[model samples]
Target: MTERKLKVYSEDEAKERLAKELPHWYVEHGWIRRRYRTNSWKGTLMVINAVGHLAEAAWHHPDITASYAWVEVRLMTHDHKGITDKDFQLAKKIEEVVQWQPGLEGGALEGTPQDDLRFAYIKYDKPKA
Candidate 1:
């Protein structure tokens, strides 16, 4: 099937949609962005891997930046040269996978049993005072 051209959301529309659908994410420059803070470097790696896998599966990639304790995901449809429904869809999927927790859906914790004891489960860090 031929690919339909992606619709680019206007700035106002993007902000409005994000406010309602993904309050945690904000429109910045030309991209919708959300930063997930992890407990440590190990947590950071876990987040990066999850995002990579999801992005690959969806064939909609996001610009990712990882640090020792956080991973920032910026989504925009490069071909459309703006934010599109594809961006929103991938962002939502990323959020779901990033926020998943062990035992939440009978899913086993990632990594070995010993690693589980040593590596802290990835979590969104609280904002600093």
Candidate 2:
């Protein structure tokens, strides 16, 4: 099959989309990036695996930088040579899955305990004071 041309967003358009739809993501050097802070290596691995799954499922991989306590995901369309809808879509899915807070929903799923750091993995972003 012939490769279809993707709509690559300009820098300004990318920034605007990020600000409106994905406040946590930022556009930089032709890529949209987001850093997720974790509590330990376990958390870092979890984040990486989650991102990998999403990227693979979406068929749009990201450049992942992972350390003991954090993971930075950078998305861009290589074929298109810029940020495209695929990047933003994958970023949103990754954000939703990686930062999910089931406990806050008051459902049967009680998310990991915040009281204990041992059980905790990802260091979720707290509201600014």
* RMSD to truth, every model: 4.3, 1.6
What TM-score does candidate 1 get on C-alpha atoms?
A: 0.81
Model 1 alpha-carbon miss at residue 77, Å: 0.4
Q: How well does candidate 1 score on lDDT at residue 47?
A: 86
User: Per-residue lDDT for 12-81 in model 2, tens only?
Assistant: 9999999999999998898999999998998999999999988988888999999999999999999999
Candidate 1: C-alpha lDDT: 0.83
Cα error, residue 14 of model 2, in Å, equals 0.4
What lDDT would each prediction earn against the true structure? 0.83, 0.91
Per-candidate TM equals 0.81, 0.95
* Candidate 2 to truth, TM: 0.95
For lDDT, the strongest prediction is 2
Instruction: Candidate 2: give the clashing pairs.
Output: none
